[model samples]
Target: MITQVQVKGLMFDPYNNAYIVILRDDEQSEMLPIWVGKSEASSISLALENVAPPRPMTHDFMKSYLDAFDAKVISVVITDLNENTYFAKIHLTYVDSEYTVDARPSDAIALALRSHAPIFASESVIRKQSSEELDQWLENLKPEDFGKLDS
Candidate 1:
């Protein structure tokens, strides 16, 4: 089972010295947080704010390639969680044929946002990521912790 979700926010994790991209369903009942690198976070942030960089970033360049090929991202699906790592797939349609490509969640999300495609997550992944530890961490987050990606 898969549930439709959206990029809720980007947050910094001081303990891990990493950024977390939060995805949540419409009702906010299920949340998935994926730890990502600074570059990936920046890309996702730019998409979230609809900020176009002076030059096309990696995700933007990828989107342009898709445009050149007349391909459309149908959706992005967070498919699995293994040993604390999450997996995702980019569903695309080109020349009347659909294809699914494996991708990191962060990259898939950035492209999805850029292409106006929907995001989703497997029900099992949602359950796996929603734990007591994560609940405590989220509850402890301060408003200042959530912000745009630092340049």
Candidate 2:
């Protein structure tokens, strides 16, 4: 089963020069982090910041192209995990036809935000990550606890 989630924030993970996309599922109160590349991270961050690029980026072009074709993104699902790699698919609807397109988690998420589509992850993926309840984790962390940590 796939559980809907929202982007919590972007965090830098120095080990692989990757950006971690943090996702939260309110109903389950769990969090999942997926590592993404710097370019993809920049796209996500730009959208989050509401910073429009001088020219349309790849995601922007995609959104426009889909809109022009009357295709609407229904949702994005992080559907599988293999050897630590995650896979995703974007579900789209055009007229009465529904289609699924394979995509990287990063690109799927970036497009989802642009298309105002819901995000989801497989339950197994969440379990694999061992993500604890958000409230429980937050309860154990004080603001000052993070303030002193070196980023």
Scored by lDDT, the top model is: 1
Error of 1 at 27 (Å): 0.8
Model 1 compared with the native: what TM-score?
A: 0.88
Give the TM-scores of the predictions, in the order they appear: 0.88, 0.83
- Which tens-of-lDDT digit does each residue in 88-131 have in candidate 1? 99999999899999999989999999999999999999888774
Which window of ten consecutive residues has the lowest lDDT sum in model 1? 142-151
The segments of candidate 1 whose C-alpha lies over 4 angstroms from its true place after superposition are 131-133, 137-151
Residue pairs in clash, model 2: none
Model 2 misplacement above 4 A: 132-151
Model 2 score (lDDT): 0.82
